[model samples]
Target: IMVLLVLIFHLLFSCSHSLQYFYTAVTRGINFPELTAVGMIDGEKFLYYDGNTRQAIPKVDWIKNNVKPDYWTSQTQIIRGSEDRYKASLVTAMQRFNQSGGYYHPFQWMYGCELDGETGATDGYSQFGYDGADFLYLELRSTSYVAPVQQALITKQEWDVAEAERRKHYLTKECIYWLKKYVYYGKSILDRKVPPQVSLLQRDPSSPVVCHATGFYPDNVKISWQKDGQELHEDVDVGETLPNHDGTFQKRAELKVTPDVWKKNQFTCVVEHKSGDPIHMILTEEKIRTNSAGIIVGLVVAALVLIAVVVGVVMVVKR
Candidate 1:
């Protein structure tokens, strides 16, 4: 789940800048919020509101430190209004789908805008989903809402061009304004780059070699394996980037090879991050953690420490 979230985060922030809002409404559920809203800037969640909380709160320190209290109050009121509307919409959607009884169904709305910081170009998107399927989406080029499912055709017909125009205006203009403002507010943290700590790990001599890189900021990283200075795409499994507890990112790529192949040829795990030059960790028996040799070394050290403690106790007794 953490990896999934981090992957989404990485994709969201792939562009130069972005501001997104997500609203979810559930028809019925146990221990689940009926309505919830989240606001994200540059892929990082900054504001969150739920039915239980009934208040819009900042999720990040930067937002709390930069945004005014009244802003939160205003956002709370806005989300409260949205909650009522979304709840009603959920019912309407269920009715359209001819669904009844106490079944859990979710209606989601997402709208966002992206800005290319380098080229000054922008893009906008608005989409709605029901029961984990695409229900409707705004066609920015045509300035109209498109219904993907039969049940949503009614909504598409009802949503007038004026509404679509208003959405477009908000997505293209207002959303970009807020995105830029948020970027400025969180520039220090958003723009900063931190290098990753790379290591070679193995469960045992026969296990795959894992190139683990963690504690990297910005979430953009590349990890690959090379055999004899040539990239090896086969027998390599690259895991998804996962979020660290401290907002950094981590990723790992495993290389499956026989001990003979690795020992005979030069195999290297290369990690590329925006923070600095690429890190290359050559595969060697000594560099791999949890290998047979490493375990033996650990046991020897522990036994020596125990013997030293026992000898010291004997000398103290003699004294």
Candidate 2:
């Protein structure tokens, strides 16, 4: 009787496993694609892709299947958008790598959160380029979990590990391409519209010709002030941004240059990243006229000096 009972239990377990497999195959609902399938990494829900629908979606665990024997985990988060959508979208991601033999194993990862909404305008349908109504194009990559192993030398079972590394490289390139597209269109959008972060309502000349920037992958940013295309080395102040709490960082940098530079030269705030092209802000004189009275007074004084010089020269000639 005991033998019969054990056989029954074993049969039930087998049946259950088979049923689960069958159910997954039959149900379309269970086949939802992870965000990674669409090229996003795992993280908390920052901005909703379908704001009215679901707030967040789990990232695909492709890296898990492709795990290396030497390394523990791999992860990434990515985004592409114009200043408005990027800042407003607020998408966030998280990743971790659990290493062996080390007391403190550091995971390497990065996040990009910004909007590129130019395509929406030009084609009269915002979904053409990168910004779709519910879906945006993005890619995430990480080389932080690098192991000492090589793919060519690995066995078939270890091929997944090599694939993970390969995927990282592929995603990195994909991310760069998307970022460039966003930036290209983002610049065009910026030329037409002022960013919300830039306070157009309040004019403060004393604000150091301030240029503020917020970025995902905060550690990779190298921000500087430039005068007529030359980099400025003085009075740069970088501010701490609130973390996304997903093991990723968001940050802002403030660079201070002379008011004259902001006025006479094309004072620009340039932001450079490790994997992508640079982002820049060209200062407009009108944007910096916080001291309207001072500018007016300076103009008046110059005009009066010119008039006086002309009158004195005329008097000397007449005499």
Candidate 3:
């Protein structure tokens, strides 16, 4: 029965899904974020702290529901700790890692840790990233790390022991049972569909034209720029599709061109996603706005002009 359930969960939850950072913060004595992945299972991440999403800020609901009961309350000795402190440390670590004083960490994007302290370990698998119409483009795990260093430091015997411990502590627990159940609950959320918004951007007349696509789902997307019906590869800079806080993704394709070429040629930004047909964008003055204010101002000015024309026509008729 247990075997069947595990297989069922593994099948369902393993797909185009959410970007979850499952973490176990131990704030008792040790203040460092744990880098334990039990042999680095599905784990990778790049977080933006100061950005619009404020992803650095941990979800209190997740902390309270999952981290609190599973890890904190499961201790045999009941050594109480502070989840609040742990949450703060998590946010702080995200900030420090993202925006350090002087040092730069080339790698350290996606991050999640299983708290093995007082709480019983995060049971089962977690579905993050795509919530409702969100596309977590990449797996929310760190793909590149100190692999050579880990190989040098961790011996075979040490590895065998750690694996044994992980299996014993993680696989055979009641948490595992609950985890599969939770995955079942989150299956629909993970599979939710979201469409992308395509737009063209350019700073003044001399700058390169940028094509942006934001808020898409299922993560399987491709965006590229084309001119004269031929895809241009030279001057184009296609960015990696990245996750948004709402679970959607954002990608930008840019190209540098002469002012004459920019004004004359009708360049296209084409996006293909799982939900539907390709979304196409062509750069034009009427279609492009730098920000929401530009849109509002344009609307307001147009409205005032319309009002003036209506009043003038009415006065002429009266006269």
Candidate 4:
């Protein structure tokens, strides 16, 4: 009974974590600035909304009870009044940056808010460019924690003045307060005790040999292909550990080699799982294809002929 209970618990935990990742993937989706672009004729920009709930798609909620056209109208009125000026500015910026080539490419501009359900850990940030490489960024972790632009675009004294002003009006405002409520929230599911099912196989005569390891929990594991007790550095392609269909995960590594190299040296695939010692599987063409199909068929035919002769002799003796 205890063993069965443990098995039941294990299954429920894996399913829960898989569901959580699925929900996050479908509703919020993974953010890729280059792909989810909102193309503008004169300029380039994109928008992201975390929404009141966690979801893959952004929601549109402007019901009568929540309608605020007057405020929005006023804000747009200012931009409408100077549409031509703004348009010219956008064109000029694009030309100066040389949209054809990336002289001063603004890779992405994103404004997002996240909501967490379980931990109640709320935070929001607006980051632009590649890891602070001439980029602008700001993050609000909580009331006491706020970060300024990551890159040193301005003097410290100038940044200090700007940051102080921003905290009062921008960071402390209700708009930001509401966004802080969503930070990919949930009761974190922990799956720490599952091992991977690994296999070693070689493709056609001249193709690359591959090691496929999959059906495991906790996406961290190592796979290596070694030859003559030496690890292969070149001609090897290792893939990232990816999630599997059943909420488990998988990864593959391949070694590119010709048949001559493969036949001469013994290559082995070694996998390291978190739960147990490393698994060692070898790759050799002879072991994989021990006999030809024709050879087996010939052996069967010879056995049938001998049995027929024995039956003929037995019939004669009985007569």
Candidate 5:
């Protein structure tokens, strides 16, 4: 499930510029707030609102510094209205599915627009999910809604073409307008480049060597393994780029090889980022801290501490 989510994130933010909004609502059985909404620009969260808080909060420094308080106030009111409507819709969905009491159900609504930096092209999408499955989505070309599940068919039938047109207009025109405005407001942070710190790590001698890179800005990064200066596609697992606590990005690629193979040939992990030139790290036994070595070092430190404690006791008795 986490891998799938990471793949989805990569696909959605592959473009240079994008603006997305996500809303989630859950039924009463869950121990969560009734509704939550998030706004992201270029895969970075900038705005957040939840039923518990009932206030729209800025997630980034640029948003808090550049955007006015009035904007948050208006957004709070609009989201509060949305929360009410989504709560009623959840109840209606329960009836539509013929679900009774004590069952947890979740609903999600997502809409976004993407802009190509080089070609000036744009794309938009609006979709909904129910219970972790696709329920309905908008078809912009036909200006109609598509129901992916039987339970959503009734809702799709009730939605008219005019509503679809309105959604389309908002996704294409208004969303892009706001996206541009936010981009200009956050140009300093968004445009800046930061390189990653790369390392090769292994849990034990038998485990795969993982090339880990962290603290990089702009999540787009390429990590690959090379054997004897040539790229090796097989016996390699490339993980997704994940966000760090400080808003930087992290990624890893693992290379599976025996000790003999790596000892004979030069194994290198290469990382490419927009910040600067590509980074190359040659894998070596000394560079990786294995579990066995760590255990031995831990025991040595423990022995030293025990000796110090014994010496302290003897000195106190002598005093």
Candidate 6:
């Protein structure tokens, strides 16, 4: 009874955490139209209320949330990316700033300094202008938490002034810092891989053959295939891998192509490694044929022998 109770408690706790994760994912933009709450451990599990189903999913560990906190850190440098893709709240914040007479330019280099500075005026670049590159809306994001996730605000300008010693760096850093503090909880990072491997297999004719390419790193790795050296335009299918549980994900990409393409041409599956030379998978086919005419003649002779044997048995029985 005790053991069973312990097992039940473990499950309850796990389910609760799962629900929390599920809730955070859905609420934070990992939309799952088919989401439902199935398990729980911490009545503390975070969940986004689903009005349709009145339930939630156990948020997976990687479902990131972008909350803003009021702190700072070194890895929290403010950098800018295209803002056209920002969340509505961020877009609205920027619009409000522009409406309020703040300069809303792309890649605005704001001054940063230590939170505690001796200079009455903080020392740093006030602003820089972009000339050639189309300025995507500016975003201040941090990879110190979730490498792929970013937090943006059109109005972080309020925190742009250098107030402290290293205020230049700090000022430059505030938006990212605040984003991390507000949005991310420090957790185990995904084990990043450098160079992943590539292999090509399963070549045939008649139907589209599935190209199996494997061994990728940096969870965000992309796989693309080409025919006779041209990139594949058709949609390729991706498959899930057995999780390593250590953070690195194993995955596969499959591309289907007509046998005619594979017949005389070189098929390549390229694994775009995050840091090293791209791994390439190459497939070539050799012509193979079977002689049907010889087989047909042999079959005919065998049938004739069988008929003669049958006739002989009948004659022996009649005699």
Residue clash pairs of candidate 5? none
Q: Which candidate comes out best when scored by lDDT?
A: 1
Answer with 1 or 6, whichever has the higher TM-score: 1
What TM-score would candidate 6 get against the native? 0.32
Ranking by TM-score: 5, 1, 3, 4, 6, 2
* Counted clashes in each candidate structure: 0, 8, 27, 12, 0, 39
Q: Write the per-residue lDDT of candidate 3 for residues 1-319, one digit (tens) a residue.
A: 9999777755665542222233233222333332111111111122212211222422223333434344433431121233344345444543533443333111111222232223334422321111111111111132111212222223223434444445345434544454444444444544565788887776566767677777776566788878878888988888655445455566777777765886698777788886788887876777765554344334335534432221111111100
**CA lDDT, candidate 2, residue 218:** 26
> Candidate 1 at 305: error in angstroms?
42
Candidate 5, residue 270: Cα displacement in angstroms equals 2.1
Tell me the whole-model lDDT of each prediction, alpha carbons only. Answer: 0.78, 0.32, 0.44, 0.42, 0.77, 0.34
Question: How many clashing pairs does model 3 include?
Answer: 27
TM-score of each: 0.74, 0.27, 0.48, 0.41, 0.79, 0.32
Off by over 4 Å in 2: 1-203, 240-248, 285-319
Compared with the true structure, what per-residue lDDT tens digits does model 1 show for residues 261-285? 8899999999999799999999998
170 Cα displacement, candidate 3 (Å): 7.8
Per-residue lDDT, model 6, residue 35, is 20
Q: Write the per-residue lDDT of candidate 6 for residues 1-319, one digit (tens) a residue.
A: 9999766434322210111111110112323321222211111222232324443322344333432222112112110121222223333433543532233222221222211112222222222112112111222232111111122221333333332223334435553353223222412222233455444444334434444333443345567778778987774665533222232334556556566656667767677755577777675543212223243235335534432221111111100
Candidate 6 total steric clashes = 39
Mark the 10 consecutive residues where model 5 has the least summed lDDT: 310-319
Candidate 3 lDDT for residue 213: 74
Candidate 5 residues 60-84, lDDT tens each? 9999998789999999999997788
Model 1, C-alpha of 173: deviation from truth (Å): 0.8
Cα RMSDs, all models: 15.2, 26.2, 16.7, 21.6, 14.7, 24.5
